[model samples]
Target chain A: GAGVSQTPSNKVTEKGKYVELRCDPISGHTALYWYRQSLGQGPEFLIYFQGTGAADDSGLPNDRFFAVRPEGSVSTLKIQRTERGDSAVYLCASSDGQRETQYFGPGTRLLVL
Target chain B: AQSVTQLDSHVSVSEGTPVLLRCNYSSSYSPSLFWYVQHPNKGLQLLLKYTSAATLVKGINGFEAEFKKSETSFHLTKPSAHMSDAAEYFCVVSLRSNDYKLSFGAGTTVTVRA
Candidate 1:
């Protein structure tokens, strides 16, 4: 069985640019989550999806950060007008459903210069 | 508000010695507590979790944590330390409201010495 997989393990972009990170959750997992971790800090929640619709987007810092799971299996986290402060590791995780244990992916390290 | 706190930012122990990582949490409702480990250049892996069903919970790699409601703590412990146990550990909490969102603590970096 394969675990959650994330593409573009690392990304470097200039400020004001845009980037997209992808995540493929485990099969049959209906709940997906995204988080960000800064250097020397724990991960902070960003957004979550239950099936094709977003269940929570309160954690998104602003309009620049948006995520989608249109097909209910794969997800994409899009960031626009990236800032230096946006530099961090973006993590993705999935669970069977709400209240179930979530498994994590390797994450994509984003650097905005 | 719900929050988690890791009392120690770092813990060092000799191989074969006991290991302890302190964590405290505050939540209005019965929360689900979890311990996750992340080695260098890797993602997080669940060591163990306590969902209010049992006070004491056992996890992988010989790690364990006890949820103490009186003191609002869920500290991780291991009888023996292994070289591979050196990594960053995070304590997380989710309220009983059925929200899958987790609130994470700063994290504790464990170092193992031979």
Candidate 2:
């Protein structure tokens, strides 16, 4: 079975620039989630989608972070006015809306210079 | 409020030796627990999960974990460590009964030596 996949495995940008990270969930998965992992730390939840709508985005650090999962199946995480603190690995995960277990993607490592 | 804690930040064991990674969780209600592994640059992989069904859960690559409610602990163990087991392991907890949000521990780094 195909697993979750993320695009632009690595991204480099300057401060104040915008970046978009994409995620492709497994076939038939209705639950999707995005998380950020900083150096020497564990992953922190960013946002989650049940179908086409975000069910939770409370974990977003600020208003600069936004994510959308339009039409379901795929999602994009957008970061506006990126700062050096935004540098980290953006991970995506998907589930079948049951069991509470999630399969993760390789993640996109973003570096804000 | 719910949180997860990995007792050890790092553990080193010789190949073919036993391995132990301790985890303790705090939750207001019964929680779903999971163990995930990340090997170097690889993505996170599910090792096992305990969703109130069983106290002892078995997972891939001969890994297992025991859920102890009395201790609020879910410790992962392996009979024999493999070089492939050298990776970062995370213990995650889902506090809500039906929520997609997960809270992860600081993670334990395992190093396998031959």
Candidate 3:
């Protein structure tokens, strides 16, 4: 009965550093997604995973952003050479499958200084 | 491509008054429309969804939305507003062809006055 969960509710890092945000989806969910929400804006899609493999990574801004769900349960979003523009709330969601309603987790708020 | 637009950036209504949040969408295919609400420092909660089966859909917390194909609109409405309804609401759209991705509208902030 647990909902999706994300660790490091808030993170502050200097520019050019690297950071990792973790997500733990619902117990039986097989589809996972990551999104970024900037101030006063809607959430932007980043990446999605169906099982252990990423089904779609088109939304990743660039090479500096990557995600992995190695064991098909937990996921980690990795950012390299973080920039000020990367400062935002990183959200994670999961569903039973591609067509199911996705449930969200309290996001990780990242700040780059 | 798929896109959603929330017409009002903010809506304020007195408690017990009717509430409306407008949304318009454009899509290349039959789209699945949804309404999500987020409280401060909290995750988004699904209000309801219209998946092409029914035009009018009812969601939690006395909220509902009607999907109108003629005007390309799916507006959220509640017969009476409650103080707890004050929060940010987002209109979302996703096409059947791209079910895995969601296109969200610039959210509408709702303020319920007592």
All candidates: interface RMSD: 0.9, 1.4, 0.6
DockQ for each candidate?
0.82, 0.73, 0.91
Query: Docking quality tier of candidate 3?
Result: high
Over the stretch B1-75, how does candidate 3's per-residue lDDT look in tens digits? Answer: 999999999999999999999999999889999999999989999999999898999999999999999999999
* Candidate 1 lDDT over residue span A2-113, tens digit each: 9999989999999999999999999999999999999989999999999999989999999999999999999999999999999999999999999888999999999999
- Give a tens-digit lDDT track for model 2, residues A1-113: 88899999999999999999999999999999999999988999999899999988889999999999989989999999999999999999999994557889999999999
2 versus 3: better DockQ goes to: 3
- Cα lDDT, model 1, residue A91: 96
Give the higher-TM-score candidate: 2 or 3. Answer: 3
Interface RMSD of 3: 0.6
Q: What is the lDDT of residue A94 in candidate 3?
A: 99
Candidate 2: where is the Cα deviation over 4 Å? none
Q: After superposition on all CA atoms, what RMSD does each candidate show versus the true structure?
A: 0.7, 1.1, 0.6
Q: Of the candidates shown, which would achieve the greatest lDDT relative to the real structure?
A: 3
Work out how many backbone clashes candidate 1 has: 0
Task: Say which candidate scores most in DockQ.
Answer: 3
